[model samples]
Target: MPVVFFAEGSAAMGPEARAVVARAAERARAWPGVPVVVRGLAATDGSAGFGRALSEARARNVADALVAAGVSPDRIRVQPRGPVPYEAMQVESRRVEIAIGG
Candidate 1:
């Protein structure tokens, strides 16, 4: 899994996130027949609805990046995992995990 962090309350991709997406896209392109799962996650902040929407947006952003990088859209699945556990750390909690073989 290749992980990329997001801002606390935003889905905008920064340079680091874009780099991660590029790496993941490369892996997906390597194994063209494999499925790519983009799991979007949020920190334990704000309301549940807020987290859900944020995660969804983040997942879509990553998925869009993958397709732009030449990964097939059909091979990508966006899984909005919503909020992380309340005890999860800030840096690690707000992220999306790109799983190339699930």
Candidate 2:
């Protein structure tokens, strides 16, 4: 079964988002053979911080980074999250279901 990791964090905008995307892609690419997807979400109340997140503009940043690191994009999906936990708290974490192998 493919593994999909949901990585959530408080990214305000700019390099922060790019950095997170890079990290997620690195982790995803680490899983050999088994397809891996790293979904990154950033939550903010629309401010300068909003500029710090890639979750708003592009989701494939993670996937693109993964491909650059040698992972196949065909096996990955990067999704944007409009609302996510840990925007204010920055420490909150959650896990949900992921149905793989459709």
Instruction: Tell me, by TM-score, which candidate is best.
Output: 1
Native-to-model Cα distance after best TM-score fit, residue 40 in candidate 2, in Å:
1.9
TM-score of each: 0.93, 0.45
Deviation of model 2 at 100, angstroms: 11
lDDT for predicted candidate 1 compared with the true structure: 0.90
| Model 1: per-residue Cα lDDT over 39-77, one tens digit each | 998876678888888888999999999999999999999
Tens digits of per-residue lDDT, candidate 2, 1-102, equal: 222233444232255445555565555556555655444444444544552354533345445555776666677654555445445534222221111221
Worst ten in a row by lDDT for model 2: 93-102
Best by lDDT: 1
Model 1 quality (TM-score): 0.93
Q: Which residue runs does candidate 2 get wrong by more than 4 Å?
A: 1-32, 47-53, 56-58, 85-88, 91-102
Off by over 4 Å in 1: 85-87
